[model samples]
Target: MSFFSVKGLSKHFGGLVANNSIDLDVEKGEIRGVIGPNGAGKTTFFNVVSGFYTPTSGTVEFKGKVISGLHSSKIAKLGAVRTFQRAALFPEFTVLENVIIARHLNADTSLLNAIFRHNTKAEAGNLARSKEIIEFLGLKDEQDNLALNLSHGHQRVLGVAMALATEPELLMLDEPVAGMNSSEKAVMVGLIKKIRDTWGITVLLVEHDMKTVMSLCDKITVLDFGEKLAEGLPEEIINNDKVIEAYLGADDIVA
Candidate 1:
């Protein structure tokens, strides 16, 4: 069985059907890209996987266990995490502190233990682990800076770092490189590969940058009007006539 699977997934609001019986499978350590124009329900799909929205119908299985309808915190504890398009870091907090807080999700220390001063070991461990995460995300030099003080690219990096601190087996990123400059985009591309190569984590990315998606993703799923239009490797997707028509108004090939 695939490490993660979504079968017959669906969601609806009033008379609007946002998602209709979508089936997606993500194997371990694969970088999958989901692309579409506005209102394609790509983000909505991510929300469903991340526990932001409970699917109206269908099942989501992770690690051979069903996770559909679980609370967000419950789902997160199952090792699935997501980063939003907008940075969710606390602007007033230092960059290092922001990531440290994220790492708290997995901390073994308990509030009661802290009250009895029995969490010294756990506390020390967290400090060391958070430091490692800071360095891993390339924020070692900016650790002391406030989150908002960092450049836009750095802020996005920090968000990814924070999500990594969750130690998720499946990581979903929403437009991680949106609004970044060419240099920043390059850095993000490298970071994505590094995360997958170094940590063996599965990644699900929703992005509009076709070049980046094609280069980074092992598999691509295309959506239009909340429906799946195509699914294949980057090369096949790029060459498919139906895929081209979905993106390029009308074909000028015959004209």
Candidate 2:
């Protein structure tokens, strides 16, 4: 079995079909990008596969088990975790505190114990891992700062760090570098590569930046109007007529 795969996945909203029989796969330690024009069901696919929404039909498999009907938390506990398009953080908390809260998901302590601040080894472990993840994402300098005080780029990376705090085998990122400027985007690109190379974490992302997708992904999947239009290497996807028409209407998705 593949590390992660969606077979004949479809999502329906009343009379409208957002995704229709989309089949996709991501291998271990590979960076896979999913791209298409707006309203092409990219968001729907992500939600279904990540268990934010149960699919109307078909299955989502992760690490050789069927995870289609599981809740988002359950899926996350099983090591497939996702981040939102926006940086979802506790703005009142410090950077380290935010990640430590996320790390509590894997803690063996009860909510009461966590809330009252137990001095157990488990709590210490969570703090240690949270610090590790914060440093891994290059947010060590911002560790003591309030989440709301960080720049947009740092906030986005914080979101990713929270996801990594779950110790996910497959990290599903939604537009990881969406609103950043060139330099920030470059830093994010390098970090993403490092995440895969150093941690062996497979990444599956939905992004609008064609340049980033082409450069960062090992393979690309194109979705058009709720169906698979094309799937191949970044070079092939850039040159495909179908992908070109879907994004630019006249030029390539990479153009």
Q: Please list the C-alpha lDDT of all candidates, in the order they appear.
A: 0.85, 0.88
Clashes of 1: 0
| Candidate 1 local lDDT, 12-35, one digit each (tens) | 877788888888899999999998
Q: Evaluate residue 122 in candidate 1 and report its C-alpha lDDT on the 0 to 100 scale.
A: 80
RMSD of each: 3.8, 1.8
Residue 45 lDDT in model 2? 90
Give per-residue lDDT, candidate 1, residue 47. Answer: 89
Residue 118's lDDT within candidate 2 is: 87
